[model samples]
Target: MRNVSIDELDDTPRVVVAIGTDYAHGHLLARHTHRRAQLLYGATGVMQVSTHDGSWVVPPQRAVWIPAGVAHEVLMLGVSTRSLYIEPEAVDLGRQCQVIDVSPLMRHLLMEAVEAPLNYDEAGRDAVLMDLLLHELARSTHLPLHIPLPVEPRLLGLCQAFVQQPNAHQSPRQWADQLHISLRTFNRLFRQQTGLSFSQWRQQACVVLALARLATGTPVTRIALDCGYESPAAFSTMFRRILGQAPSVWLAATNS
Candidate 1:
């Protein structure tokens, strides 16, 4: 792992800047670290950030945290990312970084930071605004949008297939047979690896897909069917139970 140290600038705040155009390729091409903590969010595309313990896929609505000195990398699926780079000493965030939800205000502050002049003058108003921005950012709630990946080859393959084709109407028994395992054995494996039962995992996966589709203006009936729900009512019941809001409400909240 390579570490990039940023020296204090005489005019601008002593923030070392390391910009990654496509963080996925940057991480793939080189596995490195830096003194600055990173708040990685996509301006348009999505990316996945993986640490030793877990991995998180960051869609446009989420951001992943990379603590200073943590040797982690990203897998970007697209381009034009607006990653925010912050110095550890300058910001008062707790040690050990993790993926955090980015609020609209935080997003605006970050874009403001990018546009702010990089002068070394400590007396500039940008410093005050940046500090306030960081404080506000620390209060944001993180959503579990990042799906964790399992190491077991059988489990991993099964999960990948499920995520790629979430609407597949395969029964647990069928999946167990396909995996050359008994129903009981396969159920145990799912609990062991994902800490969720087969049905629970499938439901969550289906809801994840449904949420994304709904955000894109997909009809509830269509999304419910596409996500393997018997009907929109069943999907709505499940959705309301898990999210505490209906599909329309959730979509409206996000869009608003």
Candidate 2:
């Protein structure tokens, strides 16, 4: 399935089937859609998935569930990926994209799935495997791994710029001044456009950026300073606040 189009998988009769492959760093798959919903999982790297509605970050050992017929593009960072295409009618997942943590059982199930024939036997071991896989997927935990993009063009530009060089110290007043809008107006428009306040958006962006950096074995201290935090302690504090644990503990659990 290395070079096969996802459309071809749509014709597969199985309720769920997988295509396992890997991508080099910085590889981009331009926007596309499939007839079946997809679980794009990366066992060893990060992926940034984007659609017209929003963008999501899938850190190592996790996956993103994309509903059928949504146009999305994926940028892979040296990932060992396993893609699952499922008949939406066969599953109860809602019609939205979500990031889910792949458990040990789910991980093994995915790897095993790619090894089975596309037209797998429905009354044999293959059926049981796929059934268990679907069960695990439906029960996986959702992560706060998404950063919604703004609909307003001017605000969109600002959001893109900030992502490129995020700094924790940049104040809302400074952003308002740069945009030549009053602080009150900026705050209101930002919330209206992105459904989040300036401060909230900044924190979300920082956490998303930090994930990729941390996955590459970068030190937490350096990641903090690079993201414009005053110190490692400050960065860890924020990281724990947003993610509910220190970076080391959080990442170890995910990777394990």
Candidate 3:
């Protein structure tokens, strides 16, 4: 139900419980875990979700699938959220957290879901809607919005620092030197730990960080320079290459 806490109804017999909540700008929900799987959709603004393993940025009109019992924290940027807490046995989105694309139909369904009763009838329109929503979620496309973190203390510190002040020009050799390891060893270890090459992860970090600012109406030129790009054109090229559209175009679509 609207503006309700899931904890109040966590034991409800329904297979799925929906809730809608709004957060002020720059609100943070500290680390917490849930007994049920969650499909957290941002109807507006951006969401930054972090777990022990990685971080995900969910832009407007997108959602993140958080598996049951996964401890995570969320930072909401002017966000209004529609969340689905599903019984673990009712669906298996996946074991890992994911940022998924929400179709227009799915978006409408999520808004409608938050209006359904906590104890919605099992053999009625609400049940049918919930079933359709689950089907839509299963077919949703996963996005490359996740930045996996390394477990090693030294490398993890470096990764965390870079995320705070991302720079496109940061070189792998620099990180290797800081870790006091040879470039060869760093490359191998970086891939093994994060499942991506150093260069690939660097680009991803820059793009994901840019998205948070972009959602707040930051200008492209400013964001480009902040991300260490030489020019807005250069930044847009990289943004398009990774996300398939220029930053402005993508933001427009997300807001539309």
Estimated TM-score for each candidate: 0.68, 0.92, 0.98
The C-alpha lDDT values of all candidates are 0.64, 0.86, 0.93
Worst 10 residues of 3 by lDDT: 1-10
Pairs that clash in candidate 2: none
Model 1 quality (TM-score): 0.68
Which one wins on lDDT?
A: 3
What is candidate 3's CA lDDT for residue 200? Answer: 92
Q: Give the winner by TM-score.
A: 3
lDDT of 1: 0.64
89-173 in candidate 2: lDDT tens per residue?
Answer: 8776777688898888999988888888878899999899989988898888988877878887877887888888989988889
Least lDDT summed over 10 consecutive residues: which range in candidate 2?
1-10
Q: Which segments of model 1 are wrong by more than 4 Å? A: 1-36, 42-62, 66-81, 88-99, 168-171, 182-184
Candidate 2 is scored at a TM of 0.92
Error of 1 at 58 (Å): 4.7
* Model 3 misplaced regions, further than 4 Å: none
